[model samples]
Target: MAMVITVAIAVATELAIVGAGPAGMAAAEVAAGHGVEVTLVDEQAVPGGQFLRQPPPQFGVSDWLGDPVYREGRRLLERVSADRRLEWIMRSSVAGIFSNGDDDGDEPFTLVLNPVGEGDSGEGGAPRQLSARRVLIASGCFDLPVAFPGWTLPGVMAAGGIQAFVKSQQLVPGKRFLFAGSHPLQLVVADQIVQAGGSVAGVLFAQSSSRALALLKHPSVLLGNADKLSQTAGILWRLRRAGVPVRFRQTVLSANGTDSLESVTTVPVGPDGAIDSDAAEEIECDRLGVCFAFSTSSELARQAGVDCRWDASRGGWIAKHDDNMASSVPGVFVAGETTGVAGSDIAALEGQVAAIGCAAELGKIDARQAVELARLPRRQLSRRARFARLLSELAWPGASLFDQLMSDSATLCKCEGLTVGMLRTQLGRHPDIRTASAAKLLSRAGMGLCQGRYCHFALTRLMARQLGVPEERVGGFTSRFPAKPVSIGRLIGDDS
Candidate 1:
């Protein structure tokens, strides 16, 4: 083979952290411990994720805003902050994932991040691109709530976004709410809202208790961490004790109100996992907190062209990885929820494992010692994986949920203002429309108001079903420069 040479060199100086969440912070902590210089970057100004959301200005340091996972995340970031080699860049988001060459060493890969104030400047005020012997992506998960007829109403929101609102701004999305979802996240947010003095009509599960219990029957899950098991039990108990109705095997078919959400029409799913319209019931609530589940935030990973898989058991399509937490793309390693559905603690462990693996790959650590060091985190991760699988199965998005709202007009691609009928036609015309990229190109399905955040999952599932690939294998959209919406003038490098 002829040796290929390329001029595209990724600037190498220090290890770059793509996120400042639990996973990123943990990776930086372990990597720094191993004497590797680390740079941590994130869209948020703080370390804790949307879960351990930062307190408002009104609160100094209140128990009003802390969780075990969050406390652990803060401690890890604190340790990383103390390290002289670590750099924490807040209010920065990853813009692009570029590989100048292949694994043949003809080209190198670089991660580009745009700071909040500094816009697009290929040179001046351009994003800081760090070349590294190894890179860890712990970007975390993004939820996709299938849109209903009245979902665009002012008060309706994703269960996760509502939680973020409370955590960040101390703002309640609505005074009266009905949280409808099965995941542990739904309950977590419901409790947060109630604790904040908001009235929650009920918390409903689209999946049946039998389904959830069936997942718990997995022997690996049964033997998983006692803390998580106990925590789940406590949440269920609290819901029951508080007289909060927990409905199961129910789906919120539609929300109806003039300008805002007023009530939702929910229906029951039968034994064959089909929704029965005749069993519909109208529940009055100010807000509908809805989300099926979440998958890895693959914006950066996909841009780098890392292979992904639709492991429903791991929370939809996720980046593929080996025991070392390294992706198929050699130096590009993935940690945390970006890889799978393991909780924050598991993500932290995976981040540490990636750091250890990175150190060995960079020849900073002896292979023999790396092997020994990898065991503890791996064992802990195995336990968490067991629980994660159980949780995924317990809350898997059922096909019938879509069938319940399968309308010719029900908006599927909210970003592009696209409906199911339009997407179907576009898919037929462009048989190659098998990924978020294709959808964006053909029908502009992900190019509307929310910028594909709401429609990406539906596009993935629809395309996967059409192409006969696992949902995760369907691929995702490539994140471009100005990760978030930025002014063109700002992108053109003008502060004033």
Candidate 2:
């Protein structure tokens, strides 16, 4: 005999905001202020997304990092918490999105929500449903994994992951660390490690400082984002003061260790963005922090049947959105990294724009009022987006990095244990395998717990290389429902 559990379902709201990141919080505040009943759902216990992630109250952690983003996030959380029209569903994830009705009429988007217990345990819980007239997806991004030898080692971690552990948990991953990746976030992480009394062996950036310096040519752009530039400068200054070696145009070629990361082999990138094989060098470190960049967490949007297009600079396969952040699907809006890889500032602005658009569509506000309310946010979003593009271009991983770094023995899909050589063998057996999805079917490369989030980008690049086509042409895999895994018992609730 099988056991069954019953859980009560909550009432539906006029608007539902998935993800409580800056974008979701901003959207909820805006919509609630306009007299719309808004419910914000997020997987984390705290409301802030990764940028504004808050430590548990019991942790007694203060804002020692002095990040303006976190300060702003705290303010946003307080304001959103105080909104009477808004409800927060914490530690809950959207299992799936089901839509009914046609675009001609008001469509109802149903969210299957799975609420986790303390410490995110999946045990002893039943799924619930929440329906909304309009849904706004503000799902943020995760670190893009770059595959190489020994990446599966225990001490190897994403740069963002390291930052989160250090900032939120006051935990140090390792004593000595090698930070190798693209983006300024790595530098910030390194500084955090140093402040926490850990050692940073060195910092290696795949892009050259010359390209970043060239941004100074655009004085107006820099002036407009003076605080951001200042923040970057401060992080770099701390790293310099700590005597951390910072090298540009360099990337990790391989990580080596017996059971955990012990050392990393790095190579300088050439002018054409290919690794200089002759210039390879090895550095000793206990841990390696690497992140190529970020990929948009657009799985929810994709599962909702919204159209997406390939944009490499924006971290690939971003959902299509109009000026108001409304997707092709009627009554569905997308904001933040779900639409693209723009950072938290642009995400907040886009969230406001999305809320206004959704409010007008839902009859909470007139079209004229919505337009007037959205004008400033739209302008601010455009300005922030332009700056974000500049940063993305600077941090964009080199095209040849994958081909140069990935070895035949390296594990490409860590979840499924599918390696580069195994993928090659599958391609050889099935020459018809041209896209990532087809490769997944032939080799089970992406059939894993993560559902190909970590390996899809690399797989796309690999397939493109195998087929002699562009990466975009190779494309990505189809996202299925229950964006995150859910238990069968939870799916089928108790009859009583």
Candidate 3:
């Protein structure tokens, strides 16, 4: 069920799945049911992806959140692990996906994999490769990096990153945490921190509660998600009892401290997401959790030459998938947040539909059977999509908010230590710097270690706002191969 294939030779398979998240797990299960062979590659040691992120074995964590919140994920993981046909290549990342044949040829996909923690030393291990007849990418999303002043400080981190620490490390990494974001995930993280005997200074929402809560009035959004609704109510009730302030129409204007986060200034944001700087309040806290938005982890998809369309509401560029979740590229399928940032429930639904489509295409099942198998998941996905849309609408801090938060001195690209002032100077010189790619060349904003993951959106926002064009015209970075950083040694090993 699992392996650490250290060989440089590529192990060919019928289907290769990327990511071991909810969508990937679901697809593996469905693919197995169809008697299809699958090789799933994930960066985590465990099967669960971010949503079901687990504590490392050394942590000795056994409590499963003490709720049914993770029960389904646990079950899914158990089922996937029990299947012998589904092979898991854990603790490894697909550095790049190369077509094994000509551009027009339909040859297998060659995946260059680097051991997750193994440095390029070529001492611990060599870079490996996996070959698959067809590929499915379900790489999820990550916290949207919005650079306000002091966000690059040591103690200032994304809410999701903080939550990942709590979930995967069994350690609350901070004290006196102040959460400022429009995403509801922040509430879950706050509750987790509070339950772990940590202090929550407060949780702030930029949008007023009434506007977001109005969507709950819809019966469709409320139905079939009782467990989730109950869990939310419990979290809210516990936070209230803990005397943690949950404020609305508030946003973190800027963080304060020279070396680490000591406090953050909060100000009331208008419906337009512009802050009223006069009504600012400075709150003392060691940790600042910013959860404004999430961007699709589509770097690999883009590198694989798949089509992506920009939709800020869906989280930057989303892979273009047909109804069956097959991407524009032949034999390349996509699901979950890579398609767009709906919830995990919808992710599983999309995974099921995608797996069924894969099964049909592989001749493992008949088209009629595939249609019937996909019907229920598709129906459920439609319902879940509605609720997710409502939630996304509520969580999206208006596009203007990024420009307003980006002060001249704020670090736009943390990796390169590039600031807004530096970017503006480059724009003044270039005059034609209208896209992230161009800006990256002119200002070196996106050429950092993160490859513009942290600064591309902000840079695009800066360019679009300055040029008075949509962020679409101010396009995202041109994705390149070796999507993640790889050692020169590994590249040599892959080549040799």
Which of 1 and 3 is the better model by TM-score?
3
Each candidate's TM vs. the true structure? Answer: 0.86, 0.93, 0.94
Model 1 residue 137 lDDT score: 80
Candidates by lDDT, descending order: 3, 2, 1
lDDT of 1 by residue, 426-477 (tens): 8888886667786788888777635666677667767776677776566666
Candidate 2 lands at a TM-score of 0.93
Q: What global local distance difference test value does model 2 have?
A: 0.80
- Judged by lDDT, which candidate is best? 3
C-alpha lDDT of all candidate models, in order:
0.70, 0.80, 0.83
- Leading candidate by TM-score: 3
Residue 369: error of model 3 in Å? 1.6
What is the C-alpha lDDT profile of model 2 across 340-442, one tens digit per residue?
7877777888899999998898888998999899999988877778776876776777657777788788899999998888888888888888888888888
Clashes of each: 5, 0, 0
